[model samples]
Target: MEINILAFGIAKDIFGASKVTIQLSDAATIAELKASLEERYPKLKQLASYMVAVNNEYAESNLVITERDEVAIIPPVSGG
Candidate 1:
């Protein structure tokens, strides 16, 4: 299955792109996708507070990600 992932704000810096395409197996969950990304990009591993959105709506990490799903990653914000 092909999942379209978007990296927003600082996430793009860590991921080195605004958007990416990831090939995943069926029944893949957000957690699984996250793990795969972290394995590929060690810099992203420390970003545990990121928010996920599936097809433009907020989604949980445990939620299933389908081939038809468009995933977006919104990393945690920091401000003073």
Candidate 2:
């Protein structure tokens, strides 16, 4: 299956684009997606932490990703 991810902040810089496309096995979980992203973008692993949101909701590790789902890569945010 193919998924389109929306990146923000450092995530966009690491990916070199605001959006990235990735291939994954059918019924892949969020954890698997993270692993795939880490494999392709090593810099992501260096981040303090990140989260995957599906359909506007924070996804769990076990959350299954479907092609129809809207996926976003949310990097950490800091504010004074």
Candidate 3:
């Protein structure tokens, strides 16, 4: 299955881009995706603090993600 992954803030920096399309097994969960990404991009391992979103809202780690799902990595926020 294929999924569209969106990167935000530092997440983009870590990925060196704003978004990417990844191939994942059917019924893959958010946690599984994180693990796969970490293995592919070691830098992401350290950014584990990031939150995840499916479509337009936050998603749980256990939430199953599919090829048609829109995933986004939400990095920590900072404000003055």
Candidate 4:
């Protein structure tokens, strides 16, 4: 399955684009997606932390991702 991910903040820089496309198994989980992303973009692993949002809601590691789902990479945010 091909997943389209929207990047935000530092995540955009890590991916070098606001949006990216990646290939995964038909039944890939959020954990699998994170692993694949870190593998492809080593810089992502350097972040303190990040979150994955599916269909406008924060998703858990075990959540299954579908090709039709809306996914986003939310990098850590620090505000004064």
**CA-only RMSD, every prediction:** 2.1, 1.0, 1.5, 1.1
Cα shift from native, residue 6, model 2 (Å):
0.4
Question: Model 1, range 1-80, lDDT digits (tens) per residue?
Answer: 88888898878998788998887888998889988887777777677678789988888888998877778987886768
Return the TM-score for candidate 2, rounded to 2 decimals: 0.96
Q: 1-80, model 2: which lDDT tens digit per residue?
A: 99999999999999999999999999999999999999999999999999999999999999999999999999997857
Candidate 4 residue pairs that clash = none
Candidate 2 has its poorest 10 consecutive residues by lDDT at: 71-80
Q: Rate the local accuracy (lDDT) of all candidates.
A: 0.84, 0.96, 0.84, 0.95
Which residue runs of candidate 1 sit more than 4 Å off their true CA positions?
78-80
lDDT of 4 by residue, 1-80 (tens): 99999999999988889999999999999999999999999999899999999999999999999999999998887778
lDDT (tens digit, per residue) of candidate 3 on 1-80? 88888998888988888998777899999998888888777887676477889988888889998877778988876768
TM-score of 3: 0.88
Candidate achieving higher TM-score, 1 or 3: 3
TM-scores, one per candidate:
0.84, 0.96, 0.88, 0.95
Deviation of model 4 at 51, angstroms: 0.5
